[model samples]
Target: MTGSSSADQTVSDAPTAPGGRGLSPSALATGGLVALVGYASSVAVVIQGLAAVGADTAQITSGLVAVGFSMGLSAIWLAWTQRKPISVAWTTPGMALLAATGPVAGGFPAAVGAFLTVGALIMVAGLWRPLGRWIAAIPKPLANGMLAGLLLKLCLAPFMAIGQAPGLGLLVLATWAIVGRFARLYAVPAAVAVALAAMAMNPPVSGALPADPWPTLSLVAPAFTWEALVGLALPLFVVTMASQNIPGLAVLATFGYTPRVPPAFLATGFASALTAPLGAPTVNLAAITAAMCAGPDADPRPERRWQAAVTGGVGYIVLTALAAVTATLVTRSPPILIEAVAGLALIGAFGGSLLAAVQAEEERIPALVTLLVTASGLSFFGVGSAFWGLLFGGAMHVLHRWRPAGA
Candidate 1:
């Protein structure tokens, strides 16, 4: 996803005709690839995240289907209407937060309430510039610190898997490492493929698959709780905005596409809210997949790259059918094995976040506090460590800057 200034200049100088450019085979193929890669790379993490927060198999299936539909439809709408290579995706980092946070005070229903709260917050941020600005103002180091801490446990799963089941874990890790050497983008998917094959060869004790392999929308009645709001909703919103939406817009800009931010946020926020009852979490602009669709690989002509997004959207809709199968497999497998795959998928993100967390000398101490507290899994009064980490780090940051009078 790296885009240099020279590449930006190249894309910017390409052409005009935002509305009239017709679809080409290259755009179609790139779009399809984007969808396949995006889904395969992280769907395991999504399933693991849902299950962590007390979702039963049915709820997880519904979440997968709802998330797929929401991201797919919203992406198509944005790309078609805006005529830009705008992409939508479920917040991967936020899902990691869920996996790390584990179950809340009131279980899955409470988590659903937290999800709804996040959707509302996103919409409000879109409608009110100050709120969005406020979120943006959260110190990058602390934000990355929290993310790094949240990801630490899951990132260790591969090696831990090796301890738990050496043969299976090594097989998966070897596949990921070997494929990553040649093709980094496909490494996780390759590992996932190996894991799935292994699972297929030796089915879990929980034998039967769902009676119907097709995913259906299952409504979850949300129950808001103080712990859910403070612990889950707020952190999820911050992670989604900080990690996903903002970076997604930046990716588009790097590729020389400046979409209207408010509308993009509004659309995704609305989609998240509408689908929350159906068990989906927040849907927002994509960062990595946005690059895949916006770059020259998708289409040499910037004006026509929107077609890639449209096709990618269609591809997500098509892949919704696999949600039930995916959820079933995850449910039946040993949780640690599935966690190992999820961990492998997140190693890149973990490294990036950890670096970002401690990169600035001025923010290093505060950020380190945040990272340690979060990684420690400290909790109090029913609230999770994520909120505590942010709070403690933010306190340290403010204190660090609070010199008496003028130094």
Candidate 2:
């Protein structure tokens, strides 16, 4: 409902192609674009998120490959079977949550366990309709507030990088700004290219590539802990559900495609579970990229748009080969500089979330409280600020709405 209106109008205005339903050139091109834009825009954030949860270079590479393959395969299966443009992606917002909630008590292994927990929860939510509804029922303002708070520090990295290393920071920032003016979709990717080029030219001492640059899956023994479940898993599940899955479905619906909900959730949830031991976080339906695959730009016929998602899935599978190189580049860059690119990538999301957080006058106070508490990084009894922020915000919201009996 929130992000669907304008796009619905755009699709409605597009001319319909008069031909049999089959894969078209436009679908292929748009599908490839979807894969590129989706991957390049957020890969830095994904790397940082894994590292934040204590993943080593090898583990990071594994995580990248796992998530890439999981999303690719799931997207392919869902689109092929459902005949709908049901694109799947790694949860960018959930990755942001991981980055915000750095280093759980049991470290990477525990993080793996947390990922498993989220997968199970997603699967359960798919099987139990009420659970999914409960997640969707969370107030938009509070959800956006929590997301904005999670993004606050990372979003500041660009300016902070400018202060610390103006040359590198300005190079990336300027490229993003200049490119964004012309092609907003490619802005982050362009900035990433510049930052990687700069880093390659002068690698930092601490930022060294791994001896084996080829991608390899490393199995991590999962370790469960109360802190990880309470701090990492719960918030992760909530964010993925609220920010990714719900909006993603809404996008597809806006395009007049009603793919079976349970199957999509089960597929992504199963994929997430299967890849968790390899260090991936979570995979869910993609909101932004879904628009690309499902829109008339991909194919005039709605029935044939699924081919775009299929092609996009194939593109993602091909990109899995770049995991090693991408991980190496991320590792070799100055951390702050890489974070600057990540921050640039997230600037739009931050702005949108910030606007959504305070858009409703009635919920403004509770939403602001959520944002501030989350940004404050308040942790208690091993739980991170995100959970506490939602808790406090939810409490305030309830108090605000409560009234005397028969008032």
Candidate 3:
């Protein structure tokens, strides 16, 4: 994990691939199972974000439906090309960020516009190979620092929620830690599954969920407003890029797999853009969650992870259809059950990312600056901490840059 460039590892270092064009049944099954657990944990974050942004119950449902469908399609298409299990979802941080900026934008439609702007810019970033290369070339610590800084809030959220329901949150947290000991596959599923079972068994928790899960497609007419374009949409785009995609690629490299980053970013950005009006903000690659899907032990055939992603995408579409066509069906879930589990599930992933970010010797200060500013929650002049963390960290690195003539 140290000293070696995980990205530049030669083919000889990689495990030998199975002699096959696609994944075996076992790999596919493992992939699908992991994908489902990961996606389920994050889905409620989307719903909560929409609600926070002042989306009515109906508009919130519509946004989720759109996002689900877009994610499903994007994953399927990208998996077909890459043969790796890549999944896309709402930026949990970005959503939390939006909850801060979204209300000032007047309505959900404006928030959607913000999401659209983020997609367009990110797609451009994908096309701009220089930018992609530069981002990839950045020292791992600075990137990790930025990630840690950005995710600091996420790590803290579960405990905040836990104050209300110790039983549920502790259950999920325990499951997250223990699952790895038995079978890594059991961790996320067991967390989510147990949460659901607890909610079902306990009437008070179960009552929060709809008696019958029914969600219908209700479209929110997008209101084109400049505030959303600047305040909401633009900021979200930056968040997704800095806070989500870059870290996601880092996770991929950490595991010693390299794929086309530009296309992957573009695909997720485009999907988020197309679905923004419905309420889903910038959708992008998942870092920690994707790691769960990509371990060496996940499948005998490494490539079959693509099938897991495809299965997840399909499942997302089904969820979307259900959410869109009927409002109550999926929405009638116990909020704390899923929410607490997601926060708990992400705890380890967040720690791993932060650790990587701060591990570098030369980049430590910059990474620290990035982490401090990001965790500070300082928003000034309409920009958020993600931008500030990068600005401060990158600026620090540049200020210390060495040159032959200057030195």
Candidate that scores best on TM-score: 3
Whose lDDT is greatest here?
A: 2
Superposed model 3: Cα runs more than 4 Å off: 1-45, 48-54, 102-114, 144-164, 173-180, 202-212, 277-280, 295-308, 321-407
Across 150-201, the per-residue lDDT of candidate 1 in tens digits comes to: 6688778889989988999999999988998897656766777787787667
Residues forming the 10-long window of minimal summed lDDT in candidate 1: 1-10
TM-score of model number 3? 0.73
lDDT of 1: 0.76
TM-scores for all candidates: the values are: 0.65, 0.65, 0.73
lDDT of each: 0.76, 0.77, 0.63
- lDDT per residue for candidate 3 within 136-223, as digits (tens), equals 6766666667656655665675575567677777777788778867866456657767766765565332211233346555665667
Model 2: CA > 4 A from native: 1-20, 130-211, 328-407
For residues 47-82, write the lDDT of model 2, one tens digit per residue.
Answer: 889999999988988888889899999999998877
Q: Which pairs of residues clash in candidate 1, taking residues 3 or more apart in a chain or in different chains?
A: none
- RMSD (Cα, Å) of candidate 2? 6.5
